[model samples]
Structures are given as structure tokens and as C-alpha cells.
Target: MTTSFQKKTRSKVLQIPGAKPSIYNNQLLISTGIPSLDHILGGGVAVGTILLIEEDTYGNYARLMLKYFCAEAVMTGHSLLLASADADPEQILKELPAPIIDDPGKGEATLEEPSHDSSSDNMKIAWRYRHLPKFQSNTSGVKFGHYYDLSKTMESELTQTVDISTVDSSLCACDSKQTDGEFNNPGYNSLLKTIQEKIMANGFSTTTQVEKRNILRLALHSIGSPMWGEKGGLTENEMYSPALPRFLVGLKAILRTAYACCVITVPAHLFCDKAYVRRLERLTDTVVEVDSFVGSDKEKNPVYKDYHGLFNIKQLPCLNSLVCNMPDSLDLAFKLRRKKLTIEKLHLPPDLSETANRSQEDPLKNLKPSSGCGTGGRSNKLEF
Candidate 1:
């Protein structure tokens, strides 16, 4: 016979929050700038998350994907800081979509309000493209004229301007005067100085406070390159002077000054060197891998193309390739199947637009009907 105390002390099963995956509080996840790809990346990338992309020696313009994010941030009233370790800004701008290089007012269609209807959205897109400049600009001397104002009524109007100053490099890192001994990277220091000069030219004070109204997006490309291999540098330990650490410190400093951060990298070649990837991974909240390898499609179309559409992956060594042959939206799901590209719905966070309704109803019910999250994957191809 057990005593009363012993009965009370019976083993109780522990009831705790399931250790399943979920979104975090205070995390600002933004889109991958690619609608379909964003779903795979857990609903765009969380702000301040570090994104990695791998490019082979073939010199693919991997950075073009970044132009999408940069354009999105600017349209939404964010100031962007882009750091390019090896490429020239002008060259990078050239390969991007013409609309991205054009002013926002002239590029994007001005919709009075967003609609959930696919037909309406396509109509608006067509109208905007119709209004875009037909002939490219020939004059080298372009003026920095009045552009879109976030506070004005014309904020939705697209402009035709190409203001490099808007994407200047100098506005990164912390107070230019204060020096952390950790900022021992010489290449980073040089790049920082160039970036600083550009920022100052654009009328930014080195120590000026960046307001909450502006979401600041900063990207450090090719953060750790093997070209600057650890060998033949400073002493074994003192070689903490490449683009990676300074970028880490600079990114952290900006987080306090800005509303958000976006860091991009290419690790396939450099990161394989064990030492380089380990160092770069230390400075990130989230890491997203953007993979661009879509296998050859010789069966559907006889003509060959060097490149394929982009895909975002969890990156356990080329897992992103799973969706390379698929279309980005459900509307194209049927067409993509004809072309041989597959479609897969992925789990993601609640849409920000549905926040109010979500709060009033069961959050689980907010899932979109056509949303691919629960569906098994399918694929198709584009026939040139």
C-alpha cells in the first residue's frame, strides 16, 4: 500500500512546447526577391540573415539576384549599401534587368492598390512595361535629378534615374572615427574608406543616425575569397585582415544604426577551403544558399542553353537543384509541367498582409488555398 505522499509523487509525463520548427520573435524575414524561391527559403530571408550563393569559374552573374533585393528595399524606402570585392559597380549594373537600373517611377507599374487576382496583376504589369522607355539611353553623362520621395504622394510613381549614389558604398560600418582593433583587415579597411567617401558625397554624415523609417540593407559580396588565401599574409594569427571579419564587425555595427541587414556571399570555391567558410559563417543570424544549377534539358528542346532559371535551397550540397526545372508560381505550374520543370509547395510564415485577419481567426486557417505548401512536388520544362 503506497502512502498518500507517495501517491502524490507519481511520475508525471512532462508536457513541453514541441521542439518543432517555428518563426522567431523580432525577426524580420524579407522575400528572396524571387516570389516562388522565397517560399522555399522559409518565407523570404529574415533581415540580418547572411545569404550564400555559389558560382563556378564560368563567371556567372550570381550577384544579379541581389539586384532584386536591392530594388525591393529601395522601393520600400530602404537605403542600401553594396560592397563589391572584385567586380565594378558599373559592370554589375549593366547585367541586371534594365528596369532595376532604371528609376523606380519609370520601371514598376503604378497600381492604385494591390489585388489578389492574377489577371489584374498581369494587366498592371503589362501597362507598366508599356510605359517603360523603349530605347536605351546613349548619353554617358546622366544627371542625379529628383527621384521618388517616400513621403510624397508620387512615391508610387516610377522614375527613370540611375543614381549610383542611392547605392553608395561608404555608408557601411560604424562611426568612422572609432576603431576596433578587430578591424585589422587591410583590404576591408581600403574598401571601407572608398565606401565612406561615397557616402559622404551623398550628404551622409559619418555618424548621422539612420532613422527607423528607413530599412537599411547592407551586402558584403565575396566576403572570404581564396585569392586572398591565408598564406603569405601577416603573421599566422594576425592575418585577420581580409573582407570577412571587417564585414562581420561592420554588419553588426550597422544593425544598431539601421532597421535591417542583408549580407550575400559566394562560398563554393573559397568556402571549400574549410578555414574560409568557418570564418564567414561565424557572423550570421541565418544563412541561405542560392543555387543556380539546373541540369541540361536535351529531351524537350534540341537547342542548348548555357544557363537555367535560379533556385533557392537548404544547401546540403546542391539540394536547391530540386526545383530548377519548375515554374515560380502556381499559375504557371501547368505550363512548367509541359516544359519539364517541377513545382513544389514549401512551408513558410504567415503573409504580412494577412496579419490583422490572422490575429482575429485561427492562424492555421490562414493558409492560402492555392498555396503549394502541403502539395507533393511536380516539375516541367521551358522549351526555349
Candidate 2:
């Protein structure tokens, strides 16, 4: 007689708040805070990758994206590490947009009207396509992301709930010898070290087992700019420094085995060398660039009047697979609505106005047929 053996059950995956499994690769993802952006970036940014944002010309829109990132963290109860040389992290945290809480009563009241409108709208489309599922920019069912009110700052009481850390590059102690040895910039080295320290201290490292697991969102603002103690990469003749690239490598290494992710905004437009920018992009997991039309001729053009800027996705990471999640559409634009920033498929306004339409007279009809060209007309004989 042999002793009976009991089968062991598999441990359940830790369910972190504000995070969801990606549809593409089943990796856990956290929102970038902007729902449309989260949609563009598959379900959301993966927990252990670096997201590089190429800043818009004035750095305005890029900064706003960073704020959205941090605001999402605050709303979801994730820890934040905000680093910046140009602005105080405290001030940036104070400016985070407040989360929009939906009222159940209001939703129920309007549900009938929206349903009617939707049915009518579907009826307007072709019968073959009417039954097709509607495309949603954000993930459906699970509340993985939340809408934010750009006009309102997050309440003080709300911000105090999450653990927050800051790294002010300006105040960081710099050792010239240390800077020379690795990363090439004291500010970069300091920031990297701070991030690594925070990961270990907060039990975010993969090896650190804790009772509760949460994501660490690191937001670095305006890196590679002059304020970070490096030549801002604006001049054509300036040699490319390996500092930023090295820092990214170190950062990637730190994140690979940790329960954290990072969002970095670089003044990419300021970088004169295209190859240098490419090198930086190669180092990051995901790359997006904001091309704002603020000071350009596009601002005056009617075709782009509806959008403030173009949103370009240069790269996406392949997590746990050979193929990465690709967005349905590549042409996208961003605009600031009354209360929030929105990213949508780039579309031109209909040509209803006479200014955009062609003249009433057909140009082809107005052209007289050449008398000697057609068989109906006689051509003059050439002299031999």
C-alpha cells in the first residue's frame, strides 16, 4: 500500500490595482493616464519597460503627457519617482490633473438617449457593416484606465495617499571623477543611482518578496537638455555624448528585473544629429514623438486646424514575444479639448465650404481640343 499524494494548486497572480493584462502578450500593463494614449500603446505601457517621449518643439505638450502619466499614478495608488532639473517635482505633482469620477445616476439617465442615437447611427451605415463591433480606443469592460479633468488639479488629500519620491538633478552631489568614469554626466549618473536605490528600498526589485506588490512609475522631464549639464544637442558641430545612451542602458537593466516602468521626455528636436537621436531610440523600449504645430505654417492651414499636433509612434516593445502589439492606425493627432487632451485618428474636416471645393466650371471641359490632333481635324503636311 502506497501513501496517497495530494496535488498542489498553482499560486494566483498578484492582482495590482490600476493594472491589467494586455490582450496581445498577457503582460501586465499600467496606463499612461491618457486613455487614447493608452489605446495607442496597446492596452497600456508594460510594467518593466522604458517609454521615451520626443518632446514637442516648445516642450509644452510633452510636459503635459508627463503630467498625465503622474496623475494616473496618483489616481491608481502607484508610487512615483519624478526627476527634473528644470522644475521642482513637488510643483509638478501639484499640477497633476484630477481624475474624473463618473456618476452612476447620470449614466443611467442618458443611457436610453445614447442607445437610440447609436442604433440610428448604425442604421445610417451599410447593412453589411452595421452588425460589426464598434472600435473602442480604450480597453473595454475592465476599468484599467480613467479619464482626467485637465482643468482641475488633484486634491491635496488624494495626492497624500500614494508614496512619492523626487530627484532634483541640480541638488545632486557631483563627483567629477565619478562622472568621467561612467555615464559621462554627473546629473545622469545621479539620477540613475537614485532610481536604482529607490527600486531596492521600495521592494520593487524582482528578488524582493513583499506582502503587497505595486508598480513604480518613474517620470523624467526634459532630459538631454542644457539644464542637465550637457550641451543640449542643438549645435551641428557638437560631438554626440554617450551619457544619455549609457544612462538608458543602465536604466533598462535596472527595470528588467524590477516591478517598475519609466516615462522619459527628451528634447529630441534640439538634437542636431539624426543618428544620435536614432541611437537614443535604439536604447529605449518604446518611442513616441510629439510634433506640435504651434509655430509652424501647419497652424494656419485649415486641413490641420482641428489638431494642435501630430502624434507619431516610432517604436513599440516586443514583450515576451517576437511580435509587438501594433495599433490599428498610424496617422494620429492630438488636440486639447475643453477639459482634457485627446488623441484620435487624424482626419480632415469635410470639404463643405466653397473655399475648399473646386470651381463650379469643370477645368477639363473648359479646355479646347487641339484642332490638328484628333482624326476629325486635318493636319498640315510637313515639308520634305
All models: lDDT?
0.41, 0.82
TM-score of each: 0.45, 0.82
Per-candidate alpha-carbon RMSD to the true structure:
19.4, 5.7
Q: What is the lDDT of residue 372 in candidate 1?
A: 41
lDDT of 2 at 222: 91
Q: Write the per-residue lDDT of candidate 2 for residues 233-338, one digit (tens) a residue.
A: 4322456677788889999999999999999999987776888899999999999999999999999999999899999999999998998888988898999864
lDDT of 1 by residue, 1-384 (tens): 766574355333222111111142323445444433344444445443456654433324356456555544444444556666456544444433322234443333344223324444466546655434443211111221112222222122332232333332332333323434643545456555654554444433325553323344555555444332323222236543454655566655544333445656654453435565545555554444433334424323322222243333423111223422222333211012111122243223345663656456767554534334442222223311
Q: What TM-score does prediction 2 earn?
A: 0.82
Question: Which stretches in model 1 have alpha-carbon errors above 4 Å?
Answer: 1-26, 56-61, 98-183, 190-212, 226-243, 294-384
Candidate with best TM-score: 2
**lDDT value for model 2:** 0.82
